[model samples]
Target: MAKIKTIIDGIEVEVERDSWAIDVARELGIDIPTLCYHPALGPYGACRLCVVEVTKSKWTWLATACDLPIREELSIKTNTPEVIRSRKMAMELIMARAPRAESLFPLAEKLGVTKPRFKCRDDIGNCILCGLCVRMCDQIIGVSAINFANRGHKRIVTTPLHKKADKCIGCNVCVEVCPTGHVKTLDDGSFRHMQTWDADLEMLHCLICDKPYIPAKQFKVISDKLEGIELKRICPVCRRKETVDNLRYAVVEKVS
Candidate 1:
């Protein structure tokens, strides 16, 4: 990879070309806040919280640092008044949309937004419409179970027809990736329920402990991917115990 020299907050630093501006800034100890940015997901820039002022010759403008690729002679100002104002505005709007989101409060305070000037209905849940959940299911998990529905004010993440998602494997990737506490899943021994997507999948019991470990559909996905490798239907704890027991037996035999 080629190296490029970029100026961040007036400090010149050499970084790998094609690296994101936000990543480089973070590595340089420059605090750039973000919500819709994740190392795994690779920068969707939906939140607009990581905005930074970019200067190139006479042209100067603000851009989201999450997806801004590092280029030659790129100049970035992370904590300028313009950048701070932009982030605060984005945070304020996000707070209004997700008023009940406990996670946003800390970030909100950090950005100096005590309260949002805009007000939304109380029914607006913690979903910030970041698309992390939708992207995780479709891109990484290879299951297009849930997606954005409707437009503008009526926009929401939901399964098709607001019914049970047939393609969902109950993997809980959506739940894990959700920044807000919007996506939820519940396990009641026999079944794993993805409440957000309206999916209920049968749980696969551990062969050794007889405890429900993983969802059957999720196990099938893993099984299919591994091909000929024989997989035991045991939980992680039992698998570790079995490995230890096998090693102990081998040691005893050798000793005898």
Candidate 2:
């Protein structure tokens, strides 16, 4: 509730108490790379790419910018030599686990991580294990459909028993939130298939156009939430067209 003054890269700024250091940095046009941070989800500090140097009196230490709370007179440096080194090391370790992941290439270049020192792993695919998908399903969607399965190096995101996830509504929230393109979905008119989770879902077709737009289960979840909205079985495109046509008719009637 209260505002506090903090210094980021020698630029003093006033922000709300308990505000994340990363948010303030970005407000000042400072680029702090992050993989696990989502506006709708809580900070997990999984990727460690957003590490920054925090100076409090005589003590100086590296802290995750995503979860670092801003306090009065807090001093932070995002691109110091130590911070860059830590980020480079973290990126190398992440790249080794997902060497073929194209999404990591830009960040790797920025950090000067030419090649990972560790052995490249082909088993994990592009998953950095940031837990964004899992948390989105559990915290926001409340589905709890997919989760981290194995332990240690064998850990992976999968459905229960590695079979069809009955609870999956085909909302594709996981796919949208995933920093890497690991959780893939394919819509083949008739079915929406989540290849990663091995789940097959029936598509919900638009009533007027007869084209599949979303999964049936996902529609039901949305319709249930809006109990008295009188939801029409129309796709977004058709809905927008209909709204415009109605507005035109109303304007004509008023002019006449």
Best by lDDT: 2
| lDDT at position 103, candidate 2 | 88
On residues 17-105, what C-alpha lDDT tens digit does candidate 2 reach at each position?
Answer: 98989889998999999988987887789999999999988889999999988866789999899999999999999999889889889
Per-prediction TM-score = 0.92, 0.96
Residue 97 local lDDT, model 1: 91
Residue-wise lDDT of candidate 1 within 1-256, one digit each (tens)? 8788889988899998899899899998988888888788777999999999999888999999998998778889988899889999999999989988887889899999887999764775799999999998888888889899999988999899988899999999888878888899999979998887788999999998999999999999998889989778999999999999999999999999
Against the true structure, candidate 2 reaches a TM-score of 0.96
Summed over model 2, clashes come to: 0
lDDT of 2: 0.91
